[model samples]
Target chain A: MFVRGLKSSIIALESNLKNRTLFFLLNFVLLVTVFIEILTYKHSIALEPHRYQNFTDDILIVQMHYDSETPYTFSSIFDRKLASIENVLYTQYAINQYIYNKETYQLSVKIKGTSGNFIENYDIVDFYYKTNGLPNVKKNELIYGRVWTNEEYQKGESVGLIYEATAKTIFGKSDATGERLNFGSHSIKIIGILKNTDDIKNYYRTFNNYNLEFVVYTPITYLKSDSLIDYSIMRSYNNDILKEIITNNISEKMYFYEREDVISKTLDIKKEQLSNFYYVIVVTLIICVVGLFQLIKNFINQMTFECSIRRTFGATKFEIFSMLVFQNSFVFLLALMLAIVVSIMIIYAYFYFSYRYVYPYLSYIDINIILIIGIAQLILTIAFTTLLSQKIINTNIIDGVKGNS
Target chain B: MYELINVSKSYGKNQIFTNLNFTIESKKFTGIFGESGSGKTTLVSILGMLDQKYTGNYIFNGINITQLGDRELSTLRKEKIGFLFQESYLINEITVFDNLLLNVLDKENKQLIKRIRELMDKFAISDFLYRRVSTLSGGEKQRVALVRALLMNPELIIADEPTGNLDKTNSEIILSYLKSLCLENKTVIVVSHDEKVLKYCDIQYNLIKNGKLERCL
Candidate 1:
């Protein structure tokens, strides 16, 4: 009996291919929505690890502002207190640009002075350097932030590394390592070049009125200035304690910044995105349920005579209902398979294109969640189709056979 | 044997039949003759258990059909009664073989297959077994309908104008087949307006004025 009913259902479905195609297309919307939700979830998980690795918990930036009445220096009691803390790794004082000059064919650029352990403590190594070796700034030598040829770096020449954008603007070329520039009263020769200037631009923009990419880097003693220190960046395992100690010891004119503040803001934005996605999913599910209910109701109305004919042939009401359910279930399964194939192609194309441009790694989907959602959709389809079929089957069989109301 | 005692049927304010009485016996071909709105089809529907809105006592083989539930009536119809409508009403998308085997749920029975093949051969429709019903001619469709009605070997066969759409020759062919079923101790009841079909019946009835069945010579 089951086999015969199944064969009849298949024939019925085949006879109405046009309607089945429309049905499949309508149901495909639901599958696509669920697929998008899964992709979004995977994307969030992929970005989290990268963000966590970049923004570790041990770093903090202390921005100090002082007027002439209360001048702040790193070698004062505040630094001594910070160094006394047991969890402190180290501290590095950095001076923002203190000099600025521009002349036709002979421009003098401001050089930033820092301690020797500045690069090691801040974990800033992945820049593109012109030479095979990076210049460890000591005493009189400096590293330029631009690409340079090997001939530019001769054994004992006084070299100052200039930023790539500054080199390009001043000399009309990027590899200006062999060029000479004047800073205040001293002349310096360019050496190895750095590829990017975003970090320099940001640091100068914080306190200086001029935002120039032609900045140079040298040791604090090379600058020979006592009041050029802008701020100090410290690394410690316990930033909350460091923050408390600095806040207590510093004068009322100074302020401190913590890296956790940036991390918290980024986490807030991600939370908002996830909350919005939940709303979208709920709205989509409601639309799908209502749309499927109406579709099944109309289909059952159209097949009333067919149901009556089967009933006339000794099919019980349940048997007639089961046959209709089987027919539609076959259509749903076919649509689901088609939807899956199309979704895979779409996801693959999106990831492939994005990998070449923006995102580096391909995101992954959780198969368990997909299977659960698929099963839920199947249950919704069967339940709605069966309920509507039962209602139509309860009508008088004679009226159906006679094609009457 | 079947009997309808004081059967009454109506639709809203319109009355189709009222207090009508009739009896049909086994081993005979009976024809109910009526005009366009004489309620012959309605009477067949009542007798076939397809219409349960009538107030009456329907006794079939010594059981009160009126007291039975829908499930029992369905089983009785499935096991003992077969129906043939004016339109062949076969599912047009399926083949003639599938239409004939439509009511036979247990399709793997060898005995049933043999019986279906023999019946198709007898009707000379073996050539169109695999052809879709929509592609068949009027007479071929009626023959296939007959084969389906008789597939279950029902004790009673109720046909509503089985030859209504056929020609004179095909009408005679269908009447002859119904007459032959009486020799197998099967009761064959046909409702029609055709004098040629009524002439082949062992007993004839005409529904006259005021919802009553009168005997005809």
Candidate 2:
């Protein structure tokens, strides 16, 4: 039966090369899309700074919330405790204004205020320098300038600084580095710019569908009694010690942790995106299957007389059914292969140009997707084939042969 | 031998034919004639065992063919029956040789190839052995279909308007081949409207629109 099927199938295939090519291309594309998503997720996670390779569980961030009715301000409650993490430091920043004329942003942005220790603690020394120009002040000047150096904290000088980008926006493109931009009553000079990393860049820069206005950074000493900014930053000697500090200081209602917490949260974000992706594939699959089913139905109807001829020649119902299924699957296999190939090429192009990573971050193939779709296609093909097969079987062979006449 | 005892067939409410009786003994050439919708094709289908949705007792070589299951019926047909249609129904994607080979089951490679080559030559379609059915002329395709039917050398041959699509010369050629196969002790039943095919038959029946069967002129 298989040999007979193979022979006729080869014949059918030879006669329909165009459709075969198109079908395989479709399958290739579906595979490539999934491959890229999985690969990109892993790559982004790998690029994070960690104590171990793929160390996705080490650190977290904690936020302590105060009851609004309790007559206590977040700044008042958070400031003292945050300053005392042994060998730790702190920062507080706000979003007083924004500039989003050109690009969109998809991720969120947060700013911190601190004594100059905020720079060393976040390990963003270069970022702090690039975003602000240079932190320079004359003696007894009381010059309000962006804190751009680790040396300032050791010297113990009280200063007022503004995030450089915000200063440039308020003062235009001129030398905002030395000019004081007033935040409420106190004025601060912009010193340097923040260096961009992929994760941080995505947060600040424009994506296809989102925009992040802008962030303001200032010294904790300069913060006023009344401000809307709701976040604070804490520096710790190590993540374990930080976790202990947060656990003691914050309530159970307030979540606490380190960088791993961020990664896990990011993973949840990825999973949500993945579920939406799954929905797209499923919907496309359903549409494709429905379209293909109609095609098979039409082909069988047109070939009804021929089926009867085979039946008249002693072709059994199963044989006829097998022939139809083999024919359809042959087309599906070709389409699937083509889709996979094309999809791979597109995803490869994306990963190659952006990261310059040699090995595919995506495995280039996901067998799970294939297995799932394959099983689905098999069941659908068999079910449809069986329905059409029974139709052939129920046909009175005499009328079928004569029907064509 | 094939015998149809009081056979009846209908579609929902349309009774095409009922209580029709006939017998086609072995090794004889028989012809069934009728105009359009006269049900001659339906009777042929019944005798060929392709139309099972009918009330009838079909006995073949003293066995009840009507009672056979799909597998049994198919096995019986493959071993003991072959058919030729008016349009030479061959798969257009395959070569003439492969078309014939399609009916050949899983057998030793050498034997299968040998049999295919022999049949291709015997039917005088050897020149078209590698030609796809779509590329062949009407006459060539018919000859190929005929050769395909003969490959298994079944006991019964049911041809429906076998020469309906041919020119006069090709029609004669096909009729001559059909006659020769009858001489080989195979039950050859040919259905046609053209009176020209009657010359090659030993007995004939004309199926009237009133559902009556009478001796052919």
Per lDDT, the best of the predicted structures is 1
Model 2: per-residue lDDT, tens digit, B25-67? Answer: 6898899889988986777667777767888798998999888
* Residue-level error in angstroms, candidate 2, position A75: 26
Q: lDDT by residue for model 1 over A213-313, one digit each (tens)? A: 34553221223332222233233424454444444543122322221244446667877777787778778767777877877777778778777776776
lDDT of each: 0.63, 0.56
Candidate 2 stretches with Cα past 4 Å from truth are A1-282, A298-309, A354-367, A398-405, B105-115
Q: Which lDDT tens digits does candidate 1 get at residues B1-217?
A: 8999999999898898888888997888999998888888788888888878889899998899999986788788887888888888877777887766667643546787788898899999988989988899988998898888888899999989888888999888988988999999999999998888867789999986567899884
Q: What would the TM-scores of all predictions be?
A: 0.65, 0.61
Report how far residue A265 has shifted in candidate 2, in Å. 10
DockQ of each: 0.27, 0.30
Give the per-residue lDDT of model 2 (tens digit) for A123-201.
1010111223232111111133334344433332223343334333444342346554332133344453332223432
- Name the candidate that leads on TM-score: 1
